[model samples]
Target: MDKYRDRSNTLAKERLTRETDKQASQNMAQWLEEFEATKDRVSEIKRVKSRDEDRYYELLDELEITPEYDRYEIIKGYKRDVDALTKEWLKATTPAQRDSCVQAIIGLKSDMVRELMNTQQ
Candidate 1:
């Protein structure tokens, strides 16, 4: 009976881990999709003429809600920080060490962005 109970507990733990991993992957996929969509919008803004861009910014400012320009600035700053960290990690002594650092930094930045997006929504 004890052996059977132990086996059941092990199976339950494995199932929980698998479920957690599955949810994490799904969340990551959704986050990537949202990030890409935001990037495309920002790129579209850059493609517009300066006058048009200024007009757009003015309209957003007038709305008196969350400013699109400010949000874009935050996103850009986050991207720059991530890029710098990536470069620094790559210069590390060993490939394994560099990869570990890169992964950790990416995870931290990703969590920060996720939190920001959640609050804004």
Candidate 2:
């Protein structure tokens, strides 16, 4: 009877190990799927960003403004900074954070306007 009990215990242990391995394998597969999906999403976003950048340059050319122009380039830098700040503001969950973003954006816009005025004069 003792020998039979020992055999049963060994079989139970083996079964438990198999179940744990199965669960681990399933979890790894799910993680891989999620990783692949994320990779695809990043690739799509990069493509869209590339297109937007190309369009921006095209618009600049259409307007006859070369990037070599110092004043316009400075304004462009400010615009980029403001755009980033706007995105940050949109993502901010707290009012204080949003306010900070707004202030930064306002400052950038003010600087840009000042630069524009100087260029005009």
Candidate 3:
């Protein structure tokens, strides 16, 4: 009777583990799908002539960094630190300063794209 009880408990635990693993895999798949969708949307927005400023700001806000810095200063600092530690650039500067830098860089990049578009046109 003791052996039979132990065997049943082992089987039950195995079944539970299998179920948990399946659930975990399903959840991971769902998360990956969502991530891919988000990437696609970002790509589409970036391809537009007018990039989504709100979305860009939303991302900056999500990073918990303020968006208020001189574009050139931020670009200089970011370029210097990008290969090392981007988080440091965000950290060494004030929140508003950091935000300004980010906005400046984005604006610069957008201008460049616009120039390219005009050339192509």
Off by over 4 Å in 2: 1-71
lDDT of 2 by residue, 1-121 (tens): 9899778756754553344324434342343344455445445545665669776555545434422244445555665676676667656789999779766765665565555446546
Clashes per candidate, residues 3 or more apart or on different chains: 0, 0, 8
Q: Candidate 3 residues 82-121, lDDT tens each?
A: 3232333234458776555444544443443343334334
Ranking 2 against 3 by TM-score, winner: 2
Among all windows of 10 consecutive residues in model 1, the one with the lowest summed lDDT is 16-25
After superposition on all CA atoms, what RMSD does each candidate show versus the true structure? Answer: 13.2, 23.0, 21.9
Compute the lDDT of residue 86 as modeled in candidate 1.
Answer: 54
Native-to-model Cα distance after best TM-score fit, residue 58 in candidate 3, in Å: 48
In angstroms, how far off is 30's CA in candidate 2? Answer: 53
Question: Of 1 and 2, which scores higher on lDDT?
Answer: 1
Give the whole-model CA lDDT for all candidates, comma-separated. Answer: 0.56, 0.55, 0.43
TM-score of model 3 (CA atoms): 0.26
As for lDDT, the candidate ahead, 1 or 3, is: 1
Q: Which residue pairs clash in candidate 2?
A: none
